[model samples]
Target: MSTKHFLRGMATVNYFADNVVAARDWYSELFGVEAYFQMPSRDNPAYIEFRVGDDADEFGIIDRKYAPEGMQKAPGGAILLWHVDDIETAFARLKALGATEYDPITKRGETGFVTASVVDPFGNVLGIMYNPHYVELHGA
Candidate 1:
């Protein structure tokens, strides 16, 4: 007999916030996604896991209450970058969903990559970048 194992992919990106409910709703609207799993707690009534897309089984969200203490208090200077195919479309969508723009789109070096940042309802900084070369190289 032979035994085989494999690693699938990133299951989710965990972010922390002071207000989980507000953060959850903000992210849902920003990504145009929905919540497939939500775990409530008295200490943090908004602990939730949001689906990244229509495929509910893949990606999700972990509210601050559910995250460890270190993650929960991560500084604002620590930005989380999310890779996307279209920076303009994603930025516009996030803006439409009430995300506050932290910075306009800018290219880093000559890599043909554009990036921008925004703040969620609870002040966690999120970044979106479009980089075809990166996609080809990293397979995101």
Candidate 2:
């Protein structure tokens, strides 16, 4: 029997922050776009979402208070990475924007996959990678 690939693709990635507005502003500055949606009200939103990247992926920020009951307070766990054209430049820019390094850039084998992670100022883990496969498939 052949194994099925149930996970189609990344639908949305959400990060928890104590201050959703600040997170929204920071990400808006980084992506050069504003959040297209917010919950409740703009001035007191609990969640905000932005459509980013070539694929127009949804990136969301939610107030930590709304996080699952057992969510950890520190930045750690499954790091969902986003593709980047240059890992070094992206890592540097993240650092310059006040994100602390969680993992240094690493070349995975020889398949042209380089990855790095950082903790955003809001305590969310943000990962970036230079993936040849993604570039080949997406052309970006």
Candidate 3:
């Protein structure tokens, strides 16, 4: 028998919200495109999904009421950072749009990387970063 690894990059990101409808609407407005996939019905969906970026990364929103067993409803955890051209602008935009700052933007200086994070109103930790390595490896 042969053992192999098949761990690829992130394909889906799920966000839990108290109100699925509001979360979906908020994300729709932010993304500027309606969700291409939804469960039940778009008008009253219990779960919603959106495909984003050139890679078609899966982003999802699910009602907290339906949260899986043992899932904590706290406001802290591992952050999933999205690549951005300008960290400052992205950080500012998120804050202006009501996302409270969880971690202020900080430059790594020598590494040519900067990162910032915000707690979205729906309790998800939204992160934004300017990573030169990512640009060099994947292009901006």
Considering every candidate listed, which one attains the maximal TM-score?
2
Write candidate 2's Cα lDDT for 6-108 as tens digits. Answer: 8977899999999999999899989999899999888999999999999899999999998999988999989999999989999999999999999999999
lDDT (Cα atoms) of all candidates against the true structure? 0.67, 0.93, 0.86
> What TM-score does prediction 3 earn?
0.91
The alpha-carbon lDDT assigned to residue 103 of candidate 1 equals: 82
Tens digits of per-residue lDDT, candidate 1, 12-55, equal 66666667667766766665776566766534545567655323
- Residue 84 displacement in candidate 3 (angstroms): 0.5
Q: Write the per-residue lDDT of candidate 3 for residues 25-120, one digit (tens) a residue.
A: 888877778898889998888889998765788999988888889888877778898888888888888888788999999987888899999988
Would you give me the overall lDDT of model 1? 0.67
Judged by TM-score relative to the true structure, which candidate is superior, 1 or 3? 3
RMSD of each: 4.9, 1.9, 2.1
- Least well predicted 10-residue stretch by lDDT in candidate 3: 1-10
Deviating ranges (above 4 Å) for candidate 2: 1-5
